[model samples]
Target: MSKKIVIIPGDGIGQEITDSAVAVLKKVSDKYNLNLEFESHPAGGTAYDLCGTPLPQTTLEAAQNADAVLFGAVGGPKWDNVEPTLRPEKAVLGLRKGLGLYANLRPIKVADALVEYSPLKEEIVKGTDVLIVRELIGGIYFGDKCESEIYEGNERAWDLENYSVPEVNRIVEFAMQAAKKRKNKVTSVDKSNVLATSRLWRRT
Candidate 1:
């Protein structure tokens, strides 16, 4: 059976990067006989220009059904003045919501050969391996907000930050399981002193 990979090349350098990545995937598929199929979908400012929405329904459906999605960058100053809902950055948020994606795992590892390329000192950059697990599709990003409102006769804009125990527990459990596979350590950060949500998160 062939596996379909959805490619979402968003604005800016997205096209160039995804094109090169697809070329590499093609070579690897041919060499290993992995039977991979590639499909391109528009998103971000490009999509908004062509379809009046940062994330088209077709693109979201394709991504949801694909075996995997190779997503490129999104957002640029070109679409900064657009409506909040149709902003280029909203494409990524839409995909996360439509695909039920909640975790963003970022791995930072310095290879022996690339140590010189790092801005950090050689001693600090060398032999460094770290995994930063971030929770997406929650918090202020998905919370309620007022783009503009009147409070005490003053124009105000605010975004609510919210978190539930279950939501916190799910991500924490995932991080714990990930730690078990690595160094058996997890470091969680939050501003519990000031924010009620963070206090709940810490307690959870």
Candidate 2:
């Protein structure tokens, strides 16, 4: 069966990196005679500048129709002053919600051959392999965005942070399941010292 992928290159180096990655994918697809289609769409800060909305309907539709969507970076110092609702970073949250996709998993492994290149002591960097699983597209990233000029003659901006029980449980279950495939070990990290969200993470 043919595979469809939507590629969204948000801003900055995202375009360059995604372009090179897609080129390689095309090459490998040709070698294996795999039918693959890649469609690119604008997102993030650049999209807002072009169309006045971070997540355009056309872009979202393209992604929904594709088998997978590749994303590029968005948001930067240049867009720092944009309206909270229309901020470039909102594109990610919009896509995540619209696509019905959640959670992010990142794997880190220290190559045995590249051990000597480590900045840390050999002992610390030696067995540095871990899996990081995160709840995608929630919390502060999707919370209320605000910037205000208070009566004190100072500007303040803040994003809300929150986590639901279902969200926490789901992500934790996914992480533990992933761990079952490896060493049957998991080291969950959290800032339970302060934030209630972190505390929720701990409770789950």
Candidate 3:
């Protein structure tokens, strides 16, 4: 069966990189004789300019019905002043939330061919492959009370950082599975020395 892929050519470098990535995917599809169909759509700043909304209903409906979504980065200085809820970044966040893509897998490959890219010595970074599995939809980034408010003569803002056990467990499982496939090691990073939430994360 042909796989349906929805491509969102977001903003900025997104247009350049996504085009290259799609081209590579197409080559692989042809070589492997894999049935694939790609549908391109717009979101973020460009979409906002055209439709007055960063994420359009039509785009959302198509993504919801597609087998998978290939998303590029979103956000640019032009849309920087836009309201936080309507900003370009919000569109990317909205899609992640809408699709329930709660785990982010970041592969850090230190290849000899690109060792010059890093400041570290070739000996230190060479052949160093790491996968940074991050919890995408929880903790401080998606917390409530994340707004500024004026109190008395001074201005104070507070953001609540809360997480349930299930959330932690799910992320841990994802990390563990990824680690098991590679180095069989997992290193969790957080400010456990200070934040209570971090302490809970450490305990969990």
- Candidate that scores best on lDDT: 1
Question: Model 1 over residues 96-181: C-alpha lDDT tens digits?
Answer: 99998889999999899999998999999999988999999889999999999999999999999898888899899999999999
Instruction: Rank the models by lDDT, top first.
Output: 1, 2, 3
Taken over the whole model, the C-alpha lDDT of each candidate is 0.94, 0.87, 0.86
Worst 10-residue lDDT window for candidate 3 reads 140-149
TM-score for candidate 2, residues paired by index: 0.84
Candidate 2: misplaced stretches above 4 Å?
Answer: 76-80, 149-156
TM-score of each: 0.91, 0.84, 0.86
Residue 7, candidate 2: Cα error in Å is 1.8
Model 3 agreement with the true structure over 1-25: per-residue lDDT tens digits: 8999999998999989889989999
Clashes of each: 0, 0, 0
TM-score: the better of candidates 2 and 3: 3
Could you give the candidate ranking by TM-score, starting with the highest? 1, 3, 2
State the lDDT of candidate 2 residue by residue for 94-190, as single tens digits.
9988986777878899987898998988888988889888788678877776766564787887779988988888778888899999888877888
Colliding pairs, model 2? none
Clashing pairs for predicted structure model 1, backbone only: none
